[model samples]
Target: MFDLIIRNGKLYDGTENPWTRLDIGIVSGKIANIGDLGHEQARIEIDAQGLAVAPGFIDTHVHSDLLCTKPEIHKIKVLQGVTTELLGQDGISVAPVSELTKPLWQKQLKGLNGDIGEWPWHSIDEYLKFLDKSNLAGNVVYLVPHGNIRTLVMGFAGRKATRNEMQQMRELVEEGMRQGAVGVSSGLIYPPNVFADKEELIEICKGAAKYDGCFVVHIRNESHRSLEALDEVIDVARQSGVCLHVSHFKVAGQINRDKYEKALAKMDAGRAEGIEITFDQYPYTAGSTVFHAILPPWMHSGGTSEMLERLKDPVIRQKVKEDFQSNLDYENWVLNCGWENIIIASVSTEKNKRLEGKNVLQLAEIKGVEPADAAFDLLLEENAGVTMVVHWGNEQDVIYGMKHPLQIVSSDGIFGGKPHPRLYGTYPRVLGRFVREKKALTLEQAIRKMSGAPAQLLRLKDRGFLREGYWADIVVFDPDTVLDRSTYEDPLQEPAGIHYVLVNGELTVKDGEYLGTTAGQVIRRKT
Candidate 1:
């Protein structure tokens, strides 16, 4: 008897072709049989009638490196049909961190992943060993964080690396790769990483290239300076001979909405000229991040404590406000702090729970203050530790991004706070809203974007397809019944129509509820 049998499902095999009816059999955590497994008995059997069975979704960009360290994070991610993810996104995560910088890096990103609750490791390999023992619900791969590596070699100073420092940083990256990092990643838009000049990026990328890994970049700017940022990435790929994967490829700001085609053209041209570029984007228009992203980079240079100190100085605070006002669109900026849209998904501090899910704008109006001022005040009150989502992406841009072959989809999901609906909603939204409801893509094409494409990119051996020998990372759902019920107003609601989800041949989520089985492994490079 097989371990489990999923019978009577229409399988979308991630071939970018039509769905085919198939029966899947699993044994010992691998796909044991496909097609006519009709008469075979199994230890467990699932009647997958009227469901579309396909490979479980792989998230190419995520901030879950720190989240997975916590045990509860599994239920939140697995229920969304994510079987694998590319962690250490946007240049902030704990890998390749030195003893001197670990404490500060932990504090700086507390808003993104929450406090590191007694993490014991110091090196990338040690952390991976811990992850293996953590027993996550799905597989995780990492892009060795550029900011973490830079901070390890050079402290959190906003300056270019010296030649000696640069060499040491390169060595650290090589070490991370040897320890199983899939690639190097950076947030040229965030501090410490923002401090690295283009030449520095090129050097680190070259080290990644030695391991045949890609360089995943959150470019310097996404609005006014998007083209320049894209060009810089292209130049890095050209010089370092590393593949480039652009994270959350979007044209932000009202004025830049029309620049999508132009930006895409530049990327296409670079690829034609041998840059080997691919990118990932979310299905939504609004982006989510910490409230601090609006502050000028210089104000955040020394670290979180130093940044808060400057916040107390009237002159510096005023300058910070002016800088934010210059870039922030006042009319559209929603107060994510406490509003109908601002749901508090996770709060490390017990006292802040009362502020959850209320609009920052509404809260500000109640306090007789501006929205920015309210956001600033909330951050200070929370000791510069609050996560917020901005309502600023254009639907046209989201739709436009979906139609691109090179642009795979990712949620950029921030787990804390009443997180944006996209965290739970992105994959299903793409399958249900974009594919089945709107018909932007055929069901076959949609599955390819989520499954086949990302698997090929990440170089997973036999995970993304429906072949007999692949791992049983599968999802079975009804296309007609599939829909993302989660919304900005109620972000925690589970999606509907996903009948069963299996990871490593074990059912982690079955019948739309978590089964509490943790079969996820830390996916490592084979070489």
Candidate 2:
């Protein structure tokens, strides 16, 4: 007998094709059938009348690596219909680190992933195994982060890799890929990773390419040099012959709003030359990151401890202030340092909980200091790591970019205290706010962007579509009722209208309630 049968649901294939009613049969953790199974007996049945059924959402970018270690995060994410989450995004994760460098990597990344307890330093496979033991509700796939690999081979010493060091970095990539990394990801704007020269990246990509893996990057800069960063990414793909995926692709500063056309032209040019390139973007205009990252990358060198020490020196602080002014527009400064834009999204330091919803600007004013100075002081007081929501991107740019066929939507999601609303709201906002409500895209097109498009881009073998013999990772929702309720001011609210979510033929969320089951697995590259 089949394990379950979801009958009478309007199946959306996440393609341009029209929707149709179908009955899905599941057994042995795989799809047993997708057509009429009128006589088929099953242990359980769900009559999804008047509901829309599609493949579970695949989040192309997520910082849920640490959250996957907690059982409750699955309650939030699985109920939102995400079946697969890509971890180690934006060049930060815990894998591939040796015992000595482990603490530094964990502390540096805590802003995004949240602080974790002491863990052993092991291979990439062991890290994945640890996550599996946590029993979260969604399948997870990770990119072997280049930053961690760099720290593993070379300490936080700010220098280019020598020939021997490059080989060691390469061997690490090869080993991680063999241990089941989906690909390699790097953040050129983030330190240590910012230390990576072109030769180092090319070498790492070469190793990842050997496994037919793709490289995803958060380009070096999103300001005046955004186009140049685009070109650099394209060149990496061309030279290494590995597929490239750009993360949170956007032009941040006001001056760069008009530069996206040029960015598009660059990607098109590369594609014309047979280079493989694609990109993902969040739906909002405000970008989120650790407040310390906004400092001059040089000041952040040698890791958080070094940075905190430097913050105490007046000379060093003066130099960093000058660097910030030079990087930002003095005449028309569009910074998010104040309370209007700088909300404390998450604070691992227990004493700072009161700052959670307040903007940094408001906090700065109360302290009778400049926002920049307040930002500097807070970082040091918080151990040089505090997450901030920066109002950076242009709304016009965000809307225009989402309309592109090549631009898939992602959350850049984090499950933390007063977190960015994108974690809970991105998918529904794309469907309810963007497509149905705003008319930015039709229903079919939005589904394609969220489901089949990303799955095809990552070349996930059988997921992201509604078909026979595919894994039964699916979501059932009411199209008219679906909407994201989370807002910038109150970021902790859940979304509305999603009724059920299944991972590998088991329901993690059923009838709008979390079932507390952890059927999720680690999906590895099939070599």
Name the best candidate (by lDDT): 2
lDDT for each residue of candidate 1 in 1-527, tens digit (9 for 90 to 100) = 99999999898888787878789999999999997889999999999888889999899987787777564664666777889988888888877666678888777788787665866888888988889998788989988889898888777787889888888888888888999988899988677888888889988988899988989988887776678788999999999999899998987666767677888988899889988888998888767777666677787687777888887787887776666545432222332112334423444466876666666667677668876667677778877677766555578778877888887878788887678888888888888999988888888888888889888777788888888899999988889988888887788877887878899999988889988788899998769
Q: How many backbone clashes does candidate 2 have?
A: 4
CA lDDT for candidate 2? 0.81
In order of appearance, the predictions have TM-scores of: 0.94, 0.96
Runs with alpha carbons beyond 4 Å of true place in candidate 1 = 69-71, 327-350, 358-360
Q: Give residue 21's lDDT in candidate 1 (0 to 100).
A: 78
What lDDT would each prediction earn against the true structure?
A: 0.80, 0.81
In model 2, the clashing pairs are 338-361, 339-359, 339-361, 339-362
Q: Which portions of model 2 miss their true places by more than 4 Å?
A: 328-340
Worst 10 residues of 1 by lDDT: 329-338
lDDT of 2 by residue, 335-446 (tens): 4232366677777778877777778678787768977677778887788658877777677788888888788889898766787889779888888888877888877787
